[model samples]
Target: MDSNLYRLFGDRVRELRETRSVTQEELARRVQLSRASITNIEKGRQRVLLHQLIEIADALDAKPSELMPSPQSQSDPTMRRDVARVVEMLKSEKSRSDK
Candidate 1:
């Protein structure tokens, strides 16, 4: 949780939604998603899909990059842990295979 992308994502979505004078319900309707889904996105509880992000940006007349997390947050510490765990698993599998 380096820098907690949750805040960045939540703020960005709320800003974009407000700028367009769009309600969460309205945006949800336009995007064909549930209002709860839009709410989660604004709250940063859910990650948006690439295609859905693009569509949301288009609907808001914003650039898709506007929704992206910063480079630092993109390379999250959790991701490193996940990669290390996967590598360890692969090494164990190889060792088992060799025996």
Candidate 2:
């Protein structure tokens, strides 16, 4: 997965976990993973495998797909253009600052 996509998925997982009032430690135990693993996933520092994804979704009482961002939303042309514009603007700012 793309880094941005991984981050988005991680954010979704965090949101669902919070909504279910589940702590990271508790979820870690349920999923048979370490709390650090959960933290890393929540922070987008780790990637989840298919089995882990299913375990997480099951623990949260959510569908696996619910842990993912909508493809359409992520692929929206307008959003892509906006992100590109922001990237260009940041680059321009950085170049000016470096000079």
Q: Given candidate 2, what's the lDDT at residue 47? A: 90
Which 10 consecutive residues of model 2 have the lowest summed lDDT?
Answer: 79-88
Our model 1 lands, by Cα RMSD against the true structure, at: 11.5
Most TM-score-accurate candidate: 2
TM-score of every candidate relative to the true structure: 0.62, 0.72
lDDT of 1 by residue, 1-99 (tens): 434465566667778889889999988888899999888888778776545765676677776556555556665656545543554555456559879
**Candidate 2 residues 5-79, lDDT tens each?**
667778888999999999999999999999999998988889987668767987998866677666565865465
lDDT of 2: 0.78
Q: Which regions of candidate 1 fall more than 4 Å away from where they truly are?
A: 1-3, 69-99
Separate clash counts for every candidate: 0, 0
Weakest lDDT window of 10 consecutive positions for candidate 1: 80-89
